[model samples]
Target: MNYEAVIFDLDGTLIDSMWVWEQIDIEFLQKKGYVIDEAAINQIEGAGFTETAEFFKKHFNLAMSVEEIKETWREMAIKMYVERVDLKNGAKEFLEFLKAHNVKMAIATSNGREIVEAILEKHDIAKFFETVVTSCDVEKGKPHPFVYLKTAEILEVAPSRCLVFEDVPNGIIAGKNAGMTVFGIEDAQREDAKRRAKDLCDRWVMDYNEVIDILKE
Candidate 1:
């Protein structure tokens, strides 16, 4: 794509952490005497942790504050992210290739900073990223473009020179709204929005290997 910098969304794009969220949601809700069905899960697929927490509070009629709900979800998901999550297929190789080629890389994610740092440190690839920005750093999350813009600003890269890789509709729109080229990556959790996601981006790929292959050529 001839881009100078790359921005990645963490959960489904670079790391296999969506399953961790699914597990946390199912377990947490079950413990609270409520079980969410697939349709319910789909509705909140691309939302940020805080948004999801708000949904939980309103839909499930929970009495917790948004911050409290977010913290609880974080606590439930942190152990899984630190211990069980791994990079998406071909993610590490592609990241290393970018590093070798001197392409600036950064992460713009909706996840909590603590969990994101822990996972990156565990994978030993934290150094590859020039900045790891979370939605919390900005006033709004995905679909708003604030986080992605903040990331590009931190890397001192022009929005037009940055390419974003994302797995969800909100994130794809965020990159486009930031005036950067956006690419969609497949993630099973967002299967229902697969076609929509592809339509929203400059390109779509099933995995990082597909992107790497194209970049190499």
Candidate 2:
């Protein structure tokens, strides 16, 4: 596909930060005297931090407000995202290729702005993206198409001319629903990510190298 712009989902797509969330969930639940379960994780899979906190409150009957819960999670995960999270294989090279080709780049992420900016700045790749649009910026998150569409609009790129790179099913659906081509990045953190990518995306790749090759063609 001939693409004029590239939009990326931060966690699991450009950065390997999914593990940080998994650990946060585990630690949070253990502290609350609850055990982590697949069902609980699934419930929050595609949700943003605020949405996830809402789920936690209702599921656990917690006394904390949504803001408090979100703040707690941010406190738990921000340091890790900044200090430990690193770019996925070939991510930096691909970003450089897009920059060299003058292809506009932006980030559409469900992650909070604090951590996203921290990780990107820490890796010195924040300069590559013209802007970062978080779920907090939109009323709805992925699978709704609002976030992706907003990113395309902000970048002044037509949805048809944009190519979205995502690792999760909701994000894949969001890109396609917004009338853009979506490429799936393999993320081992989500057990079904590869299968879902093949099922929902316009293209699927194990890493950014495969995507670079596709763009080179």
Candidate 3:
């Protein structure tokens, strides 16, 4: 019952980052004279920067570059991740357990590399993963399967032999579409987020602490 590799989604899964995205999105739109609420933020949470920017452009009629949208979003999240958003309960302990067990680990996140690295380093958990796959590194992001697929390929592990822990529906679908077993995590405060994704995930758990037990089963 051993898996060869473990792939992780950064936000919400490894850390309490879901609600922060809403804040960033809402603030970014407000600055441009647009109003956004829970419904608006939920619709864009799992999308890549480009997709999210496109949504904003169409919704608010902005002419901003995707990079600009990404930069502005990162500007809000980086400080929060660094100054706040402590690792989810048992995330560090779980990482150490994986390292001790010699589990091959990688991060496949829709977050930009700059922000991802900042959070990982700030939390002192960057060394646990062998690779960090961000949206910028791939032509496609989550819910498209490219990022998770590329990660398993880079780790030289069969898709079926890898397990993915994700907090968003997009990421759950991406992992399952890649032929990996997906475990969904949730944040109680983020009620607007989809708890299901294309009906492809294997199991839904509330925290990372439950991962080891699932793997054993």
Candidate 4:
């Protein structure tokens, strides 16, 4: 695909940090005397950071306000992101390839600004992107197309000329809804997610290496 700008969803797409969330969810909910389940986790799959916090508050009937809930999760997840999260396989190389080709890039993520900034700064790849937009920056989250469209707008790229890389079905749908082509990245923990993402995305790949090879052609 010929594209001008490349927009990435951060968690499982640009970084190997999805596991950090899974672990945080387990530990957080367990602390509140609740057991996290697949159904509960699925409920917020593509939701933004604030939206996810709201879900936790409503579903779990927690006494905390949305902001407090977010703060708690942030505290729980930040150290993990800063200490353990790394770029996806070949992600830096692909970013360099895009930079060399002068293809504009940006991040459209559901994660909060703090976590996103920390991880990007940790990898020193923040320089590659023109902008980094969180779901909080938009009115709505994935499956709504707002975040992706917002990123494209900020990049000053038309939706049709932008390419999105996402790892989840809702995110793929968001890119498609924005009238952009999307490539789905495979998630090792969820085979079902891979099938769903494949069905939704324009293309699917195991890692950024495949994308680099294709773009090299």
Give lDDT per model, in order: 0.86, 0.86, 0.79, 0.90
Clashing pairs in 1: none
Tens digits of lDDT, candidate 4, 75-156: 9888998888888999999999999999999999999999888888899998999999988999999888999899988999
For residues 111-167, write the lDDT of model 3, one tens digit per residue. 878888898888888888999887657887778888988899899999999989887
Give lDDT: candidate 3, residue 25: 69
Query: Candidate 1's residue-wise lDDT over 1-217, tens digit each?
Result: 4889999999988997777887888898888899987766766765666777887889889878989888888787778887788889999999988988899999999888888888888999889998989887888788889998999999999999999999888889999999999999888755557778988989989988888899988
* Candidate number of the best TM-score: 4
- The predictions' CA RMSDs to the true structure, in order, are 1.9, 1.4, 2.3, 1.1
lDDT of 2: 0.86
> Best lDDT goes to which candidate?
4
What value does the lDDT take at residue 105 in candidate 2?
96
The stretch of ten residues in a row with the least summed lDDT in candidate 4 is 186-195
Can you list the residue pairs that collide in candidate 3? Answer: none
Can you rank all candidates by TM-score, best first?
4, 2, 1, 3
Worst 10 residues of 3 by lDDT: 190-199
User: Clashing residue pairs in candidate 4, if any?
Assistant: none
Please tell me which model should have the higher lDDT, number 1 or number 4: 4
Query: How much is the lDDT of residue 25 in candidate 2?
Result: 84
